[model samples]
Target: MLIFVLQTLAEILAGGTSLTSTKQIDFGHPIDRREEATEPILNVYVYDLRESKQLQHSGRQFERNKTGSMQTANVSWPPTWIDVSLLLTAWDKTTLGEHHLLAEALTILLRHRSLREEFLVPELRGHGNLSMTVAIEPAIEISSLWSALTIPLRAALFLTVTVPFEAQTVPKSLVWDRIVSIRNKCLPGSDVMTITKRVAIAGIVKNAVTNLPLTDTTISVVGTEITALSSEEGLFFIEDLHFGNYVVRIDCPNYLPQTVNFLVESQTYVIKEVLLTPV
Candidate 1:
């Protein structure tokens, strides 16, 4: 994904300016020796990459079905967003030529604050809308960056591109449509009667001491596989239950598991609040 982003940026600059194609734009370490034949070239180097903490999610596993149908998928974190830093430099035999190339490159980069979908590569296409920011580094930092590269300080454009790291997915169980039926039986003497009942349970889970909303906490119907995970706000719900006695269990890391017994009568909805003590 990182390489594809860099190549996309190079392509954008190449097409927008007099630089015909990506061939004129090279990707390598600036410290490497430049060939005389490849003079007046553009060099793109990736300097750093880090995951975006703001977009991080706690879940690590995801599930999806191969055939498209009415199926439920346990998708973990969709994809981790990462920030990649790139350095673009113009290398030439003459200072004038170098400045000329740099000027063209800067003009192209400045024209578009973000790379659009039309400019993305084949591998990146249809993933989603992705945009990259193009900006110049401060003059004071340029010296340190070049020093780190162990090369003489030269004019360069610093580019920061945000891209997604693909997540791992596994095939899970398939879901099928559910059907329910009710039949009425009448005795020889009198009248027919019908009965209908439904129940829904909703609740919030929190830390006992901190009272902070605990996300990814699993709440399940005791003897049944039906379960729901608490959201970031610590809210969870289990619906479409028949009236009966049930024991619900809550399990979360670093917290003592809890089980609550409740009897559902003719009520349509039931609300409960749970606080888990730290183990």
Candidate 2:
């Protein structure tokens, strides 16, 4: 993945600048030796990698059918967004040449806020476009960075690229076999079939006085063993219940227990909010 990004950037700069050969572009540590004896080179050094917290999502796995087959494939949880920081430095014997190359590279990068899919390699093309931001780093910070690298301070552009990691894929079971086996099963009875209807009950528990969420509250259906504990957000859910009238009881420490009656219907979700009175 790192190679692909560097290559793409090299391609863009190589095409835009007077330097026709991509060999003039390099990706390595800033302290590395520059091949200035041959030609002026543009070095792209990746210094940091971190996950983007804002783009994080629920880690839920899903399955999709492969092309032209009844078999399904499991796709691992969504890819995580990662931020890659690069220091772009132009290496030339003359200071004027260095500034000119840096300006050209900056111009090309600024033209595209996000890289186009057509420019990406085959592996990254399916992931969609990646976002890139070019910014100027403070002189003090830049000097500190060069000091840490044990190299002389030079003019450089700070580039941050946001890209997604690919999700893992695995083969899942075939659907046709399960369907055929179910159809083959025969019950020695009339042809009339009865379908069972289910209902979903979901709600949140809160404090009666403060109206704040009450976590760790236990909720149960009367005359049944079905029960669920309220989450940190004071939310609880119970599903696959038969259509009927049910009494829901809520219990929590230092709080008065409460009971309420609700009706459940087929193919419907009943939402209830329980407010527990504090002792």
Candidate 3:
């Protein structure tokens, strides 16, 4: 997977900018890529690769698909952002010539926002445009990198690209679906009184015109404590509802609030077509 990502990066550099049809571009250590004499070439060294600390991630997500008698749950992790830092050094014999090559490379890369889809390999096509930033400020100190390579530092362009690393699904068996609770209380020398009975209500909220599921919608039973927030697929479940009439309220951003009255006569009630109109 790493190999595919790196190969695609090289393709992006050569295809998108002035470096098109240029075979002088190479990857790996800069010193090894330099010719013995003054033949100019650009070497791309991957100095750092780490998970981006900026992109926030939500909690884990799980989806279930039922097949005949078997039900399985698949855990889908969020796509991770891998920040790759590349050190672009121009290899030449003379200082003046090396500066010229570096300037050409930097000129071709400056003001670029993202890696285009045309240059993307098959694996990277649908992952969205790879965001990139190029500047003189290397992610790591140039002197330190040159010291490790046992060579002197030269002018280089630091390029950072954001790559999304997607994870595979892990399947597991589905557990029990429903659970109910009952509570009983007795007063001093008095008859036993039932406090509450477990009842459930579930439904999906959608756009009235588009008929598309609305995520992050809030569903609640008015005048009661039972409530639930809609999932990504617009499904909401309010558990432990009382066996009586309910005024359910649905609220979402940029959408008008809605209220519906329903009487629950059974343990489970599934409401349908709970649509909300947009403002």
Best by TM-score: 2
Cα error of candidate 3 at position 143, Å? 2.7
* Reference-based TM-score, model 2: 0.54
lDDT (Cα, tens digit) per residue for candidate 1, span 188-226: 443432222222566678889987778999999999988
lDDT by residue (1-279, candidate 3, tens digit) is 466556775665565544544466777577754556345667787878998887646678989787653355778887888888888887766778778777766766663466766666787777667777888887777678778877676677888888778877655433223443212111145443222312256667888988777889988789877678886667666654435577899999999999987765443455455989999
Off by over 4 Å in 3: 16-23, 36-39, 66-71, 173-279
Measured by TM-score, how close is model 3 to the native structure? 0.53
User: Cα deviation of 41 in candidate 3 (Å)?
Assistant: 2.3
Candidate achieving the largest lDDT: 2
Model 2, span 1-279: residue lDDT tens: 788888888888899887778998878676644544367888888887889765666676776665542345555777788888888988876778889989988888899877888887676677677888898883236767777778887788988887787655544333221110111012245254222222256677888897777888999999999998986667676655555678999999999999988775433454577888999
lDDT against the true structure, each candidate: 0.70, 0.73, 0.69
Sorting all predicted structures by TM-score, with the top scorer first, yields 2, 3, 1
Report how far off residue 266 is in candidate 2 (Å): 46
lDDT, candidate 1, residue 38?
57
Q: State every prediction's TM-score relative to the real structure.
A: 0.52, 0.54, 0.53
